[model samples]
Each structure stands twice: as C-alpha cells, then as structure tokens.
Target: MKRIIPFILALLLLAACGAEPVEAEASPPPPMPTASPLPDYIPPMDFEPVSVWQAEHFSGRALLYLGAEEDGVTPFKVYSCFMYEVTDYLDGNMLMGARAFCAEAADSGDFSVDCSNRGLWLEPVLGASALTGKLSVDGDRLTLEYTGCELAAWAEDTPGFEYRLSGGQPVIDSGTGENDSVQYLPTEFKRLPDEYLGRAMYWMPMFEEEASASAESVRGLRVGDTYADIVARFPNPLDIWSRDPRSVSAPDGWYDTFYGSEAGTVFAALFYEGGVPSTVLITCCSYASFQLDGGLNITQLSVSAR
Candidate 1:
C-alpha cells in the first residue's frame, strides 16, 4: 500500500511538468493606408519669338533726308520709314530703310502709287552707305540715327536722294512759308514672324534654304494623298493653322490648310478636294504654287524666287 501511493504522486508531478503553457492572443498589424491617385498632366502651348522689327507709316507731306546737305533731294508724295533690330538673329545689326512714293503729276488728281516692290536699305552714316546704324534705347523706345542716309522713290528711279541727319529729325521745309521738323517715333509696332523677317531681310540665309527645301519635298505629295499620308511625309510643321472642311461648296468637300513655323520663314498651303490633296502652295524666300488633278497628280507647277 505505501509503494503504490508513492508511484501515483510521481506520475501526477510528471504530467503537470509536460503540459503546454497558455499564451495571450496577439493583435493584427494596423491596416495599410490607401494611396491617393495623381492628377492628369496637360502639355503647355509652344511659342518662340525670334526677333523684333518695327515700322511706322505716315501720310501727308514729310521730309526724309540722310545728312545735312539736301543734294539730289526730291519731294516725296508719300513716305514710310522703317527700323529693324536684327541683333536677336543677326550679328547685332540695327538698320533703317525708308520708302518714298513720288507722284509723276502731283496735280493730276491721283496720289496713289504702288510701293510694294520698294526694298529696305541701310541708312547711310556721314556720307557713307553703311548697312547698319548706331542704336540708342530709352524706356519702351529705341532711336536709330543715321549720318549720311540715302532716300529714294524706288529701285528704278534713283540718283539717290542724299542728305545728312542733324538731330535724328527731318526738316520738313514745306516751301509754303512754314518750316517744321518731324522725328521718327515707333508708337504703333507689330511683332512680325521671325521666319518671314529673316527671309525678307536676308538676315538668315539658311532659313530660306531650308524653307525652299521643305517646299520642294512637300511637292511630292500627290493630290490623291490623305491628310494622314501628308503628315507622315512631312512630320514637323511650325503648326497646322487651318483644317476646315468645305461643307457648303462641294458635297465631295475639301480642306484649306496652312502649315508653317512661328517665324514664317517657310510655309505651305494645301487645298484638299474630296478628302484628297488637290493643290499645294509653298512659299520660302519665294513662292511655288502647284495645281493637282483629281488623281492627286501634279498638273501645273509655278515657282517664283526672290
């Protein structure tokens, strides 16, 4: 009886020691935060300014002279003075050019003359026909004074109206008992496209060359080509200004389109008929007008170079 009692006590102690421990439950990790979505991105508009050119148009009687002496001076019926700042694209050259329209019969009742062909010239300085002038700048204003400037009616009619500038002002001797002076001021100025001005003034010859090349390349685009095909052929244009369908004119329809750079150094106009190109006009330092047939084939090509 005593041996059986001792064995039972030892078995109970072994069972308690072998039992597993009870552990407290652990809390799950805090849930991760939801990420916020980002806003959509929009592209900015492209704009690049190349240079500054300003002109002032004046009517009525105005005297234009180069230097002090008024030799070879002819009275102008109409006058237009211009100032060009080519420092941005050119080698910091400031030039002045003027156009004076002289009427053959001042009393013939007509004061109109075509001044479109008249070209700009570098205002002479001190009896010299220099290509550029000295520029002076004030607040919102620029003054270009020429020493020995030359004035003329046009390229064809010229002995060269030569005179010396006294105070950057022209002495308007009306010869009617009135002596008044007029100064050039650029109050109303318009910023012209850099490309156009560069080609027109011969400031950037390479721009002209590139424009010519682009025009020639685009000419290969046949009249039957789609707008997509045209874009594929000529990828980068300055911009596509127009893309309106000809709904009213023809049921087949057409589109009048213009493509060029911001400066307008070179540009092309494509007229699409029946959703196909019919005509293409390219202008770069000159103009090339192309007419196409119904098959988008080149039928007529007229090119003019300046």
Candidate 2:
C-alpha cells in the first residue's frame, strides 16, 4: 500500500511540472490624420500687373512687385511694392509715382528697422509713419492688409485721410498676366481746355507756395527761356530736367534713368496752347505715365528722396 501511494504522489508531481504554450496580446499603433489641400480661391502671389489711378483720379499705369519664399516652407512670408506712372493728370505735376517698401511681422523685428531699411527712402512720398501692415501676394492681385494700426504719424491733411495713401485694398492690373510683358499707361489725353490744363500742370506748384525756401516750387516760364531765367526768378532747385513732347520723355534719360538713380529727380517743360505757350509744369519723378483726359499730366508722382 505504501509503494502504491509513493507512485501515485510522483505521478501527480510530474503532471503538475508539465509546461504549456502562452499567447501574447499586441499594442495598437497611434492614428495619423490626413492633411487637406490648399484652397483654390487664394493666389500664389499678391502683386499682379494692373492699372491704377493717381491721387487726382487720373488713369495711370501700375505695376506691383512681391517677394515670397521660392523654397518650400510652411507659413511663408512676403514683401510687396508698387510703381505707377502718371502722364496726363494734374497738368503733369508728377511724371511718375514709385513705392518700394516692405512690412515685416507685426510681432517681429524692430519697428524702426522698416524705417531705416525701406521707409526712409519712401517716406517723402509715402510718409515715414505709413509703414503699416503685411503685404500679401494673391496671384495677380497685390493686397495691402493693415494690422489694425492707427498712429498720428500716418495721418494726412486730405479728407478722410485717404488710407489708400496709407493703407488698404489690392492695386490690381487686369492687363498683365503670367505671360505678358509689363508696361504703364498714360494718365491724360491730347484734347483739353487751357485753363483746366493749366490747372492740371500748375496746381501742385500753386499749393506749394506756403512751403519754406527748403521746399521746392515750380515756375511757369516760356520754353525758349534759358536756365539762368529759371534760377533767377524761381527758388533754387535741387536738380532740373527737361521733357520732350514728342517722346513724352525727360532729359533724365527715359525710364532707365529713373530706375538707375532711384533718387528723386524733376522734369520741367513748357506746354503750348493754340500755338502759344500756356503753362510750365514740373514732371515729378515716378515709375509710369499714362494719357487720361487733357494733354499729358502726371497722375502719379513720387515724393520720396533717394
């Protein structure tokens, strides 16, 4: 009976020591969300070729420039600029208007950096405090988006303070596209009355009377008059240039001179009415010129000093 009992105990121990296969449970991977494509309504850049009128409401040729990241990067940044030529508005007070300046992040960079880097050059025309907002490039349209900025420095004497002078809207040129060569349009036409035409050319000069000797003014003299005559009667000019009616070009050597110097230069000339000299207008430096209503007047003029 004892031997049988020992044998039974050994059998039970062997059965208890036998091994069995165990199963393992795996962990599930984290989920990944799909990304959506960019919207179709937005353009690649803001600056597209277009026509813009002058402060005087005369038609002028306009072109825009936009700088964006060519390299592929997220949350891209951009810079924008504008160039316009007014040929025949305001009796040619301004031959052209050019604006090349940039606005950085509202939260990034020193505020005066813009002034030193770009605004100082454009301030005379655009005002020093005018640098406000991010320039957006939406394909062919150039949009100037204001960053909720309101400072006394940007305020102008004009009615409503014309924020377009300071901020707002896209200056679009419908004529230019991806394949088209850029060009400007004239602000004025050939047929116009003398008094109105004289006003067109002489208005800015007339308004400038209150300015001190440091400020520049225009003198209406005959075409045949010598340079001495120009200097003797009018205030001393910082610089002078002559305009050719045939080509609508100034001695500043056409558009090339304007681009090269980047300095503010003036073009002066005598216009004839009924075969008689009528008025003398100064061609204020700008980027483009266009024919709009009467004779060639400057629709856009650059006030910045290089």
Candidate 3:
C-alpha cells in the first residue's frame, strides 16, 4: 500500500510541471483628438485700370493718357498725359529723332508744352492736342481710334496733306483718309505712379482762382521768415518738435523743427542752414506739402494724399 501511494504522488507532480503559464492582456492606445478648422480671410480691393492712349511723339512716341480708378467709396478719376513731336519714322514701327513735346493732364486742361526750338522741324508739325478717341484694351493691346475731323487733326498733320472736307466738316473714310488707328504694345505703355494719381485728385478743385489765391498764402507764413517770425505769426501753436541734424548725419548747422496747430491738423516744418531759416514746409489736408527754400522761398511743392 505505501509503494502504490509514492508512485501516485510522482505521477501528479509530473502532470503539474508540464502545464503552460498564463499572460496578461495588452491595453489599446488612447483615441487621437480631432483638429479644429481655421476661419476664412478676405483680401483688400484692387485698383482698376481705366483708359490708356498711345500716339506718335517727337522723341519717339508717348502714351498720351493713362487713367486708373482710385480705391474708395467715392469714385475719383486720375490720368496723366505725355505729348511728343515725331521727327522721323524708322523700321519696326519706331519713331526716330522724337522730342518731348509736352506734359499735360488728359482730363484737366492744364498742360505744359515745350515750344523751344520750334523753327527746327516744321514739316510734320505736332502740337499739344487733347486726346480724342474711344479708348479700349483687348488682351494686351491698347487701341485709340481717331474719328471725325477733331480726332484726325489731333492724330497727325503733314506739311501739305489736304483734308477731304464735306459740309464744312472733314470727311473720314474707312481704311483711308481722316480715320486713323493707334495701337500701343505692352512695352510701349506704363502705369502712372500712385503719387501722381493722388496729386491729381488733390488739385482737382484748384481750378478756382479763389482756391489758388488761398494756397498762395501759407497761413501768413512767408519764405525768408525766421523761427521767431513764424512763432510770432501763430500765437497759440499746437505742438513743436525738433529733429537733430547730427543724429541723421546731416551737416546742416541747426536742428530742424516742425510746428503744428492746436487741433493737430495744420503742420509746418522749418529747415535751417547756418542758423538762418532756409526752408519752410507747410502741410494741410487739402493741399500737398508746400515748401519754401532760399530763406523761405517757395521752391518745392508736392500735393498728394499719400
């Protein structure tokens, strides 16, 4: 009975040693968080190109008018014009021996024509004439059509070419006399600077004699006036500030100071050389910076909103 018991115990121990061990379960990774979307962004409005005119000029050729629409609630039109006299025509549609004939505003009647050395070239007489045509642009070409007598006369004039007159008006024939076409290539045209456009808008109302007269007077501050003189002119001045010439590496003798009105609206800058007031710059909302140099002499003026 004791031998039987020992054999049975040995059999039970062998069975327990042959059994496999158990393992722990692995945990799932935490769920990733969702990302949020961003807000929409809007851009500013773009400046629109209005009209462009191209014509033959004395120096070569010139873009007579380039117009652009100002960016604002109120619509303001601004344009620039350059006039030229064509001396000769070369191959590849190039004008030879051309000169700067004039500079003018296409919309406004104000213009400056260079009449110096008028007797030199008298054959193809090109004068300062207002731009006349229905200006349009297609793809990259700028087209200007000279229709009727008014446009034809301004387009070109030869030494002895006769105009086919009808009913006391010049007769314009299609693809022939009177009617003319001017096309400007991309290389020939250019965009006027924004400063000039701003200047044009500012001076739009200066056509009146009263406005011009008022502009001439710089709040009773004339050129050649000393700093003390200017101070005396404005009893209750708003603010006064100075800029050190040495800080700017300027060799000028004294510091430059700017004075303004009490309301912080009107401002004027005085420049000094050798301790004498050499220049004065007056600024107003309506006009550009009016400057007087040579002891307060009004030498430089720029009227611009920007």
Which candidate achieves the best lDDT against the true structure? Answer: 1
Candidate 1 structure quality by residue, lDDT tens digits, 13-55: 9998998987878664333222222222111112122334343
TM-score of each: 0.27, 0.26, 0.23
Cα-based RMSD of candidate 3: 27.5
lDDT of 1: 0.34
Q: Model 3's lDDT to the true fold?
A: 0.31
- Across 88-191, the per-residue lDDT of candidate 3 in tens digits comes to 33222221121222222233222233333333221111221322223344554543332323223423454343333223222222221111111111112344
Residue 114, candidate 3: alpha-carbon lDDT: 31
| Residue 98 of model 1, lDDT score | 28
C-alpha RMSD values across all candidates: 24.7, 31.2, 27.5
Q: Mark the 10 consecutive residues where model 1 has the least summed lDDT.
A: 173-182
lDDT of 2 by residue, 105-223 (tens): 33232122143322322332233343344443334333434433222353333223322322223232222121111112211122223233212222222111112112222233233
Off by over 4 Å in 2: 1-59, 68-98, 104-113, 116-125, 128-130, 137-142, 148-306
Model with the higher lDDT, candidate 2 or 3: 3
TM-score of 2: 0.26
lDDT of each: 0.34, 0.29, 0.31
Show model 1 residue runs off by greater than 4 Å: 1-132, 139-141, 145-148, 151-243, 248-277, 282-285, 289-304
TM-score of 1: 0.27
